[model samples]
Target: MKEFALIAELTRSLPKNDTVVVGSGDDCAVLDLGLPDQFVLFKTDAVVEGMHFLTECEPEKIGRKALARCLSDIAAMGGAASSALVTIALPKKFDVEFVKRIYTGLNEIAAAHGLAIVGGETTTNPERVLISISLLGLVDKKKCILRSGAKVNDAIFVSGELGGSLAGRHLEFEPRLAEARWLAQNFQIHSMIDLSDGLASDLRHILHASKVGADILASAIPISRAAKLQARAESSSKPPLLSALTDGEDFELLFTVNTKDAVPLLDGWKKEFPKTKLSCIGKIIAGHSLKLHDKGGVRELSAKGYEHFA
Candidate 1:
């Protein structure tokens, strides 16, 4: 089975409690935890050598990517990161300096985000290095965003450009933490998710949770220069538009808002994040299918984004 299929099966019978405000199927698991005004956001992510990074990659970048992945999930929930516990599994005979360099990168990013590296476990993995991060965050009860809040006619927006993450953005991209917080604080965001799994796949998460569909405009997609260049440089590479649709690890924010707020959000985003490019790529519809629109007109989008065990 594919990764999501297995996840659906496993999550079907998971244990839960009253404190579980949102569990499974979200960017982070939200818990009430008896907090009067805030909800606790919990997220865990892992990066494996060879799968997520190469052996030749810098240890610092590998460590940074490990933590940044979890931070992106926290940002997806529109929360502020608080602390983290890291677990690193390595071969029994590991280089001491390399391990320390990994922590150096992790610590630097953690400090920049005001997140403390509290504690964790170090284990042995016989073959490759694996770094797992469990992050904790807090969000205002009313301001928390979820994939399930999208509604019909809501306009979908994506932050920054998309595609060609393999070129290096995957290791160094900044989490859209501040951008997500600003959107939640300033606008009535209907729904939000970070684009880690590419727009094609991640948008489906919102649609599935919200019980809506989307009509994406191909021409409106903001393709990254890397994506365009890759297409031009390599005949075997996916076209720029397709890469923008399916290249995972963009780590940008994908969100929706009422159509009435679209103009205002764009205007506000420009003033708030002049360096970031926010594009209104689509709109939610009544059904449960994803469709793409271009000069050729509308058609069901059959292409899927990256998936494990596919």
Candidate 2:
């Protein structure tokens, strides 16, 4: 079965309470926690040796990627990360220096983000290394963005360029925490998500949650230089456009706002983040089918990002 299908089945009957404002199916599980002005954001992410990183990959980068994944989810909610607990499962014959180097990377990012490393556990996996990070964040009650908020005619936007993450961008990509917070504070962001699973798959998540669809202009998507280079360098590689649609781990912020707010949002972003590129690529529509508009007119978008156990 596919990863999403398995998740749906497993979470179908999970226990819940009144405090659970937003649970499963979102970038983060939000809890009302009785805070006067803030909601708590909870997220957990895991990285494996052979899957997320190569065995020869630097341990420091590997650790950074593990924590960065959870941070990106928190950013999707327009929240500030607070603390995290890390659990590492290693083989019986693990290297002490490698584990210490991993912590070096993890600590550096955590400190930079003002997030504390609380506590966690160490276990034996008997095979490859597996690291899981459970992160906590907080967002103002009124500023928290969710996937279910997209509306008809809302403009969809994405931060940074997309695709070619496997060429080293994935491990070094920074979480869009500052950008997301700025967007939520300056504009009425309707919905948002981080692009970890590619534009096609991640955008579908917002549409499904909002009970809507989107019409994306193929020409408007900002493809990365790395993606273009990869396509030209290898005959067997996917085309740049397709790579932009399906390459996972972009880690950029994808969001929506009122159509009227589009121009102002773009102008403001240009001034606030001169180094980053934000693109207005599409618009939300009233429907259930995701469509791509290009020189060929319109067609249903059947291509999707990578999924586990598909």
Candidate 3:
């Protein structure tokens, strides 16, 4: 079973909040303040030693990734990150210098994004290292984008390339803060999300929330050469392109805009930020399932984003 299905099945329903602008399925949960000018956004993400990091990976990178993962959610909401709280569960064998280096990495990224580390907790764990970060951000209430706002005829867009994040893309990916800011200031984005999970799975969140479907063109997905190389290095039977489709942790932005407004906005985006390539991969439709069209012909796509207990 896919991740979302399990979440819907196992998790009990909670009282819905009218203040929630975007909740549960997107990158961050946004709360409305009722003030015409401002809204608040919150997000939480956790990193586990065995699941999210390699045993020998640099302590600094691990720390940076743990924090950056949450910041990416703020970027998705077009919000300015304000403060963060970090909770760490340290294993028995952890050293002082290791912890210090990890804090250094986290602080570096936080400073770069103008976010302050306000408070947190430290705990002891016998088995593995775990880090959880929660972030608070602010946005304009009228301007906040949501996953449920997508229209049937909107054009789907993705920032940067996709796939093979396991080959170091996850470690070094820059959060799309500048790009998201530009998008918020200049364009009318209908909905937005960060592609932490695979594109198929993440896109499904928007579709399901909006009660729509999508027709994605496989040929249009932008793939990095690094992703192709990694796929070739890891497998011989299946095309590396499949890895690009299935591999998660590409922290790029995936958003949608009205079909009429997409072309001009895309042209401006290209002229402004050439490094972050933008690609139009699909269109929203009036249905309940996702379809992918490729050389292999049309097929139903599965929503298989990364899940903790999968």
- TM-scores for all candidates? 0.97, 0.97, 0.92
Backbone Cα, N, C clashes tallied per candidate: 0, 0, 0
Candidate 1 lDDT, 1-310, residue by residue in tens: 2898999999999999899999999999999998899999999999999999986889899999999999999999999999999999999999999999999999999998999999999999999999999999999999999999999999999999999899999999999999999999999999999988788888989999999999999899999999999999998867788899888899999999999999999999999999999999999999898988877667677547322211
lDDT of predicted model 3 = 0.84
Q: Which 10 successive residues of model 1 have the least lDDT summed?
A: 301-310
What tens-digit string does per-residue lDDT give for candidate 3 at 25-112? 6677778767678888889999998999975889999999999889888888888899999999998788998888889999999999
lDDT of 2 by residue, 78-180 (tens): 9999999999999999999999999998999999899999999999999999999999999999999999999999999999999999999999999999999
Looking at model 3, report the run of 10 residues with the lowest lDDT sum: 301-310
In order, the Cα lDDT scores of the candidates are 0.92, 0.93, 0.84
A best-first ranking of the candidates according to their lDDT comes to 2, 1, 3
Which residue pairs in candidate 3 have backbone atoms (N, alpha carbon, C) closer than 3 angstroms, thus clashing?
Answer: none
Whole-structure CA lDDT of model 2: 0.93
When superposed on Cα atoms, how far off is each prediction in RMSD? Answer: 2.8, 2.9, 3.6
Task: Give me the runs in candidate 1 sitting further than 4 Å from their true place.
Answer: 303-310
